[model samples]
Target: MPDLPILLIVVVGIALVFDFTNGAHDSANAIATIVSTKVLSPLTAVLMAGALNLLGAFLGESVAHTIGSGIVQPEMVAGSQGLVLAALLGAIFWNLLTWYLGIPSSSSHALIGGLIGAAVAYGGWDAPLYGSIGAKVIVPLLLSPLAGFLSGYLLMVLLSWLVVRSTPGRVNFLFKKLQIVSSAFMATSHGLNDAQKTMGIITLALFTFHEIPEMAVPFWVKLACALAMGLGTASGGWKIVKTMGHKIFKLEPIHGFAAETAAAAVICTASAMGAPISTTHTISTTVIGVGASKRLSAVRWGVAGRLVVAWVLTIPAAALVSALCYWFLAVTGLAV
Candidate 1:
């Protein structure tokens, strides 16, 4: 086995790598609608999203605190740094696979699943703080998407009613401009929720190594994660972008504006509450809801069904992989 300091360095590097993959994988959540609606060119949209994502990362550390200490027990993590490595490997593997397949699964869930699986593998089933996981992670995981869908549907309906007397050309022209603000709001919220997950992971590792007296995130850790996520967002994930922007439903400027507005509101609220909800799930369901407000058949149920399947499987699949990773590390005598 390598020295502890060296291993600690490797774990931090991998955590940042996972953060980068997270940004690339979930960038579509921030910009897909605006791109699909032609409100902004793809290049312009990603650049803007990347900048806002960086800015939003500086907003708060509540989500980071939850991630660092809310799910796993600190005592178990104190010496078992290898388990954290396995968890990150599991998440990165899942994120890449889903990105290649153009599935916008939740990176947030993938990380949480990886942590749960690795913790169980290393320290038994009782290692995790089940109550915290149930309340902070699971409840938010289940409810945020529902909130997004209902909000999107209701908001779209309200918008349609308001514009009923307006000309189609007038509505399109008005919303095209408004969608830009909504898109920026969505991107900022995405950064706030998503970048903090990496911050929490790195801080957890530092706490494990006794480098930090407590689980508080250091400023450097936050800055590094924010930059990694921003660069990854700039690199873009075009395949998932196609799936998110065009596969579930065809979006016009009005629909894009409504969906972004609803999803952003849900995400920002979750961030404030320190719930690491999936921006992907929130945005996807909002798109569907916005479309459904038009009619039942307006949404491509077949595509939406595939997304649901991926969502349901993400936790278990990533968990299984992380468990296997932990098992391998243990067998190799590398998990201390």
Candidate 2:
């Protein structure tokens, strides 16, 4: 038990590291559209996203609790420092890889997959909370991107038709103003959902070591998670920004507005339900939707296809890495 407290501290640190990576990896979601459309400078977009993301932390905590306790059994997580470390390492490595590749993969899924992989490696069939896991993790993963795609597509078509006769200059002027409002919503949704993943992991670590009561997420922890992600977003991930903003599609102000609005809505909906979906997936798919509205050829299916491959691989890759880390630690006698 004495060792458990020390291990818990280590896991908390790892969780924050994961949170930081999450921000860097997913910052593309918040800034891509605005930057792509030239509605905002990259620097300005990131700063806005970071600030609103921090502000968003104050919005809610339901999602945080679900991630901390709803995924796996606390009793099993107890005395499992090796497992936690493995899971974190797995997710971290994947984030770095995808970030470098300019693929906006699912940070949320990577973390969840890492945990599942680590738990399965260590616990086999005894991994806790599979039923809830399916409902919360897998179901949302499938639906969020699709929801973003449809929403963005529909919104863009409607907006385009409504302003069909308007001058391009006037349309740009109006959406430029509207982008600020929608971007805030997107950033806020980001904080409400993405920040909660870290909060959950931290809370889970605390509960694993018996530092908290009944796996509850505390106010202070929520603030810290939000701050970590916001800070990381402020620091920025320029490589991904370039890819998301320029490579996938040619975007204008209206496209940016539609994509951001759609992404924000999907993310916020998932957050309110305590479900953690990938902000990366949601925004990327939305961007595609906007681009596709122009024509199939306009969307650059090649780049997007590669991104899809990365998204599909994220969970298993992180999970495998975490499992390997767990095995190495266990065999080396670092975790018992």
Candidate 3:
């Protein structure tokens, strides 16, 4: 068995690794519309997103606190490095698998699912605080994407009707310039919401092991977690970018601006309420809304259906992986 100190370090390292994966996996949410619309090149788009993500990290810490406390009981989590390790591995593996498949699923759901799965595997179904999780996670997840779709659909319809008399070139030219603002909004919302998840996990680990006080995620903890996520976003997740930017919708500047703006609005509102929503789901649904606004034929329902399947499977897939890892750790008596 590894020494307790070394085991703690390893667990924390795994947590950060999971955080990095979260950033790379979700970076597409921030830049997909901009890239698809040619508002920014791949490299410039990622760089812009990375910078805004870093700036947005300081916006709020409520979501972090929620994740740290809302899912599992603090007592169940404490002194269990193996459990935390299992959770991180589960989330990381699911993220990589989805990215490889070019699926835009929820990294947030993956993380929570991992933790709940491992916790249930070890402690049974009642191990998780299902009430808190239901109120905070499950409900919001269901509503957010639907909200994004409706909002994006309405925005596009309004924009189109308002500019119907304008030439296509004039509308495209105007919206191309406006896409910059929407892109910034998306990036900022992505950072504020997604990075806090990593912060939540890290703080949960620290609190569990008595490295930090209960109920408070330290300032330094927030800064370091935010920085790690920002760096990961800066590196970009190129594979999934193509999937989000081109596969779901062939967007023009107008579609991009409307979809991104709608997604940003939903995400930022959720962030203020400390809900950790899936930015991927929000943005993808928005794009679908935008595409459908032109006509139902303009949207590719077949491809969109596949993505929804991936989202449905993400949580359970991550949980299964985490549960297996936990079983391995328990059998070997490793310090993970």
Candidate 4:
């Protein structure tokens, strides 16, 4: 047998690469509101957001456990290290593809889809825990955006009603100040959930290698994923920032504040629930909800529809890519 540690190392490296791509692709989720509201310059916003994301990564492991052991049984794959690598390759490629096209796709879904695809490829038809996947991932993925939209719409309506007598300038000035706080909360919530995905995958790899008898995320894996995600956030991605900060809806300070707050609440709640959700999906729909609260036509539904199509396609598309990747690895005898 090959030296498993060497393969594990390579897989861990690839996991970090996936985490980096995730941070860059999803950084807009961390900073979009503050940037759009002009409450902070893009640079300042990302830096602040990145720092908070790093801090938040140290929060809990419910999400990590969900991804690490809930998605697929790690021991079933042939050369499990190779499976992770193939899966990361598929997910990373999808993330880069979507980023280049300025689509706010879900990295969480991509990784989950890749895991399922690679598992099925390696273990034939009986590898995945379908019920766990549906409960832990699919349901959360479907509901988070809807929660964001509903919360944002209601929150905006309430805020508008409460501040009805306030001058427009006063409200804008106040929300501009508050937006800094809301944006940071969103970024922290993002790190709480998204960064845990890689930490979970790496831990699952450890279990596959028998480095640990049980599936548990080590502190070192947590630190590495957190730092990688933070660095990627610092580097930033302008493409999706444009899509998120503008295309979904034009935001004034109050709109930005409302969307950020609502999305942050939904994500944090999901994180505590051990469910992995797309920060992008939540934030985009929150913006749409906030816009619609002002006027139904205020949201760019065409763009929103296109985004929804991409969201719906993310799982199947990434799965197909990872399936091909697994096939290539198997045919080459690389995973044997």
Best model per TM-score:
1
Q: Whose lDDT is greatest here?
A: 1
Q: Deviation in angstroms for 260 in model 4? A: 0.5
lDDT of 4 by residue, 145-252 (tens): 899899999999999999999999999999999999899999999999999999998988888777888888889999999999998898898999988889888899
Worst 10 residues of 4 by lDDT: 73-82
| Higher-scoring candidate on TM-score, 1 or 2 | 1
Q: Give lDDT tens digits, candidate 2, residues 251-304.
A: 888888999999999999998998988898899889899888878899889999
Candidate models: Cα lDDT each: 0.93, 0.85, 0.86, 0.88
Model 2: lDDT equals 0.85
TM-score-based ranking, best first?
1, 4, 3, 2
Of the candidates numbered 1 and 2, which has the greater lDDT value? Answer: 1
Which pairs in model 2 have colliding backbones?
Answer: none
Total clashing pairs for each candidate: 0, 0, 0, 0
Assess the local accuracy of residue 241 in candidate 4 as a C-alpha lDDT between 0 and 100: 92
* Whole-model lDDT, model 4: 0.88
Q: Which of candidates 2 and 4 reaches a greater lDDT?
A: 4
What does candidate 3's lDDT look like per residue over 55-141, in tens digits?
888789989987888888877767776777788899999998888877888999999998888887677787799998988898988
Off by over 4 Å in 4: none
